[model samples]
Target: MKHQHCRKAGNVLMIVGLVVMVSSIIFSVLNQLPSIQMPALLAQGAILGIFIGALLWLAGARVSGRERIEDRYFWHRHYDERCRRTPHH
Candidate 1:
């Protein structure tokens, strides 16, 4: 269904965002080393990647339906707990 597709796309975006962000940070750190002497383009690219990754992550979080599912689980558990505590006549 369309819902499943959206969820899948969100998951992919989240994964790619995380990967890009982490890799960019690692490369940026490597660029700081004396022996590496990385080009200025690397620094610019890393910054750009980090920004894009953050946007993708935020977008994915918004698109994903996980929060609703978690809310459902939370309410179900709460109701169950409250019911168990009250003795039925």
Candidate 2:
């Protein structure tokens, strides 16, 4: 079957990576308690994963979705507007 959303497999992979990263952040933060040391190395790894996800998200946002370039452009306009409203570094 063909994907109606992302055009490439790489884009899907990026989305999955992004999900894992976000979930990791949520897990780490929610697990943060007096007893949970959450070793510095692991915390750093989570941060790195989050960073990787953000980058992949950016890439997928830049290059994925839709069949025609026009459709991509339309979605991109929406994405750009959303990004503008969001706080970003």
Candidate 3:
């Protein structure tokens, strides 16, 4: 799949997960009854959203045509050089 598609799917999954989690919270609150399952459901939704979102975002970043300076070891070397050149108090 294309990077754009992956990114879009990730966004959708994240949004759906957030909605599910929020709804679960509201359901539990409005019911005024503490249920063990509610906590489990909320945790699942949040974890799923964050995990999938991170995966997709990473995929998009990896496949994108642009080069990332952060991804290069040379960048780190240059970073140290630049830091050395800067005045420190």
Candidate 4:
């Protein structure tokens, strides 16, 4: 009961946060389109990077069969087997 409610709240927050972050980036890019073009590009890039970070943060919150899918994706293990094979030296 309480645990389930917490989980639901967490999910909602994660989704909302991701959406807000991405929308902010979109707005920044659009706003910077005209004047101050060079600075705008830099701002757009920063915003996009932050947006990606936020999405990754949200992805980290997801559970998959008791494990987080981000564990594989963030580590690049699912796509790059060599990374998994190499020792953490």
Candidates' TM-scores? 0.69, 0.53, 0.39, 0.45
Pick the TM-score winner: 1
- Window of ten residues with lowest summed lDDT in model 2: 59-68
Each model's lDDT comes to 0.82, 0.68, 0.56, 0.61
How large is the C-alpha RMSD of every model relative to the true structure? 5.9, 8.0, 6.7, 7.1
Compose the digit string of candidate 1's lDDT tens values, residues 1-89: 48888899888888989999998998888988899888999888998889889888877766777667777777766666664556545
- lDDT tens string, model 3, 43-68? 56655655555554554454553237
Name the regions of candidate 3 deviating beyond 4 angstroms: 33-89
TM-score, prediction 2: 0.53
- Show where candidate 4 strays beyond 4 Å: 35-84
Stronger candidate by lDDT (2 vs 4): 2
> In angstroms, how far off is 13's CA in candidate 4?
0.2
Name the regions of candidate 2 deviating beyond 4 angstroms: 1-6, 65-89
Give the winner by lDDT. Answer: 1
Task: Give the Å shift of residue 58 in candidate 1.
Answer: 1.0
